[model samples]
Target: MNDQRLRLDLAALADEVTAVDLRDRTLRTSRRLGIQRAVATSAAALVLIAAATGTAFAIRPDQTAPPLPADTPSVTATPTPNQSPTPTPSTSADDPSGAPPSGGSGTNTPSVQFGKLFYGPADVTRVKTAILRSWRPGGSTVQLLALPDIAFKGNMSVSSDGHRVAWVDSNNNLVVADADGSGKQQIRSNVDPYCVGAAWSPDRRQLLFRELAEPGGPGRFGMLDLRSAEMTVRWWASEPAACNAVWSADGRTIALTTDYGVTLYGADGTKKRVVPGFSRDGWSTDDVVSLAPNGSRVALLRRNMGGGDAGDVARDLRVNVVLDTRTGKQVTLPLGGRTLRQVYFQTDGSMVVRVQAGSGYAVLLVDEDGKKISETAEPASLKDMQILAVVD
Candidate 1:
């Protein structure tokens, strides 16, 4: 009932009933990327911590705060429906190497196709501060800025064009800045500290995050429009037991992982369909649901919690399941028998999938139909690195 008691009980329950996915843990602990790792290891903790810390200012139906006034410059306009949603690189006067800026241009520069990967140290507990870095897959990593450790715990997000990044800081303030860590702006201060996820809208003008309606309460979803600096709360008619939100590439639909399954909603927040049996109840995490670019399908990491035997746990958790959002049918992936660790959808409908190799993992670019396009070259050591955003 109490937060401490609940955390202890959940830890005990985890030890008794949950199987630890060693590969998943290794990837998460080493790379410190993906929300699934958090869901797998700390879902219960996140819920309890949120409920505990947010009770004092939990949102009430009648007491919702008025939208904060816009203080920062408006975000770039959303791309037209006919235009590509991928980001073009901006000219940076700060960096001569052509690397992304740490504090250079805003969003006003001319657009050209730009590709970069943003990632950083996964474990910042010891250091207190986390350093974010940007690098091409095979190129040198550039140090961006040092941020609070909380910024990386399912709270950090990179824009579709890989030009911007957003995260929640230690004080529960939502901050947005450029990919190289420049032009920092604090959008929302004192947001629910336990909100475990943040996602960039496809057009890159807004962000999606989880909100709690009350202290120690159920979950609600909200969107922050950078262009207007206004917050919109959706799913107000009902509360999900637990959830995480993601946007479709077209910016037309939003998908949420819930205790019941994955639910789809239009941009206007109207429920479209419910893909049941993919709930986050037993073994789902915040990073499990990734919507396709076209908003027709969703990729889910459905962990196969092994039998009662402890020895069987690691092997069972490597399974993955993707579904057709329209039909709620399971779709098979052409993985060539490699265990799928995680899957992320790109703006073009293709996916970058992480699969288990002998002691590490491999990244593959795959087509919409599940055909492998090519394998990406990663750095020699991924020990504390995580791929935050990708633009091809």
Candidate 2:
């Protein structure tokens, strides 16, 4: 009976040990599963946070995240409604007029057409050799001629059609040449060496110039027919300083500025009218005078001689006085307070003016009513240069 009891107890002990070992194994497996679930939950939470903040967390095929470019920022996949894409260049045809398209650079836009402007040295007295050049608006200057021993102390006159130019030479001879300095001709010799101005007729067939009876004597007006090569004395003036002949566009009237005032004469040398406010003694060396195409108005520089000695007087050189020959009253010009340097009347009764512009000069085209039409800045190389003629 004792032996049976022992065997039964041994069997019970073995069952108990087996049960404890199974429980221990179950606890270990539960703890291991709990740790895996916690790790997976944390990883999912991180991915969710990155998506909500618009930060991309890229995963590689190897289940690892690589570093992003330092310079690049995390961007959202969707764009706003107002966002515009970068524009690509177009290959369409350009404008037919060679003008830039709208919203293009204005620096490449075409400038206003001011025609060819003939100019020379500002101070000819200092240079023995000088060049005549032509400047077009928005174009480079081209040398037209090289003058040797230039005797004329004034501006040259270009024909209305821009075909010819006329000036006096060092030999006291009237020289006429093509606009390009070709086909030169000495039409008249032994003429007044100091005849500072000349004018071309409306037909471009006659030239009006000054003639002196003798050197250092009083001068008169002369007209030369280019076709016939005939010369005629048109008018006789009593003053020695009477010169600067300007013609009306119709070629019916002529105007001369004298020491006393401006004298208007018919084409037949008859006295038409005398507009008397100008004094040649007070005028500057480069003083320009122009007559209206209809012979109704005259423009000149007005000098204000202040109180002082003749040599020390302060002369104002800024005022431009345009007088109506019929009423002898000043016509107001819209100059915008810019100082006038020179003025020339166009064939259409408009005026081209050179005004002082901050150490350089600017050209302005104004209508008959003194309204600004267009303006262009002169090249810096033409500072203090003279506008001899405007070829339009």
Model 1 off-target regions past 4 Å?
Answer: 1-115, 122-125, 138-140, 211-220, 229-242, 279-286, 305-319
What are the TM-scores, per candidate, against the unseen true structure?
A: 0.63, 0.62
Alpha carbon lDDT at 346, candidate 1: 57
| Candidate 1: tens digits of C-alpha lDDT, residues 1-392 | 67999999888888877555677555544332222222234665655443322211000001011221121111221222122222323322222344322211123212211235555554443555667666553344556666655565446676766667777665557788875567889887645444434567767666766553444333455667778735544434544443445666666666765443567776556776776554433433233346665566677655432322221111111227777776667767766687876566655556666666566555666656666655544444554565555544
Clashing pairs in 1: 39-285, 55-215, 102-180
lDDT of 1 at 189: 62
Worst 10 residues of 2 by lDDT: 55-64
**Per-residue lDDT over 143-234 for candidate 2, one digit per residue giving the tens place of the 0 to 100 score:** 56556423224425667655566776645577887766677888876555333334676667777666635423325666777788365444
The residue-level lDDT of candidate 2 at 61 comes to 8
TM-score of 2: 0.62
